[model samples]
Target: MERYVDGFVLPVPTEKIDAYREMAAEAGKLWIEHGALEYFEGVGDDMESDMDGMPVRTFPEIAESSDDESAVFAFIVFESREHRDEVNAKVMDDPAMDPERPSEEMPFESGRMAYGGFRSLVSYEK
Candidate 1:
């Protein structure tokens, strides 16, 4: 079945990777509990690439991050756009989300995050 995905690209300070992981783990649980099919978060490992000498903007460059920050790519999967909306509504209402929390307290710069929801154009699984 075609699925929906909410993706994010952001910069996280390398020094707070562990903290970010912890926070992401908790958030993932909330998402799953609220009905997300899957939740995944990954920090940049081998992001720097020249693309065989072709000019390309790297992940860090896209996220506008400094050397001390790592590019983080994350996503949540859902049955459909409606399903995603339902799950997100519940998750947002959950106190764990801290809807009113200060951005400065977050592990990464919330303002710099690039987020979007996408309907799957093609999908395959083993």
Candidate 2:
């Protein structure tokens, strides 16, 4: 079945990776509770050497990350485009997810974060 995905890439200070992970964990839980199919967050491990001859840009390059920062890639999957919108609306309305509410400050810069929604063109599972 085709799926929808909301993806994001950002730079987080290297020293704040653990803190970022903790925050992401809570965000992931809220997303799941709101009906997100799956939520995944990954910190760049082998970003530098992996793109030896590739012409495409790497996560760090795209994020303009500094030496002291790590590139973070995250995604949340949904059953479809409409489902994604529905879940996101509910998630945003939840007080716990509100940006205006008092909460631990983000470990990364929000202005530099890249975000997008995509419709899966190909999907496979065993």
Candidate 3:
């Protein structure tokens, strides 16, 4: 039973890229120091795919499609849900968490920025 912190980020306007990048980098470092297992960032590009029929892929695919600048995604794995919750609480309460703020010039609506805590229902890896 592994716990993870998943985040979905949409970029700010072109003019704000530098500011956003700096913010995200600082945020990643803070999360790591606060107990995050891993942090990763990626940029989105245009692509064609049919996502209407697949609920699992719909959101991510659409996110990539519409993302002209970048979208940051991160995952932090914990030994158990309880531990995850504990670490998350500490992380949230830490003053360092404030540095990850999204810029005012964000291209997408703030409501669109999504985040969640997830437990591994099943996994296959080699």
What is the alpha-carbon lDDT for the whole of candidate 3?
0.59
Per-residue accuracy of model 3 over 16-126 as CA lDDT, tens digit each:
557666866876776677677767765444333556776354334534434354554445666566766777788789887665665554444556566667777886545
**Which residue pairs collide in model 2, if any?**
none
| Model 2 Cα lDDT, one tens digit per residue, 3-75 | 9999999999999999899999999999999999999999999886456676878899998999999999999
Pairwise TM-score winner, candidates 1 and 3: 1
- Best of the candidates, lDDT: 1
Overall local distance difference test of candidate 2: 0.92
Give candidate 2 regions above 4 Å deviation.
Answer: 49-52, 101-104
Candidate 1 structure quality by residue, lDDT tens digits, 1-126: 999999999999999899899999999999999999999999998886858889988788889889899999999999999999999999989988876877777899888999999999999988
Q: What's the number of clashes in each of the models?
A: 0, 0, 0
Worst 10-residue stretch by lDDT in candidate 2? 97-106
**Which 10 successive residues of model 1 have the least lDDT summed?**
96-105
What is the Cα-based TM-score of model 3? 0.62
Each prediction's TM-score versus the true structure: 0.94, 0.92, 0.62
Q: Which ten contiguous residues of candidate 3 have the minimum total lDDT?
A: 58-67
lDDT of each: 0.93, 0.92, 0.59
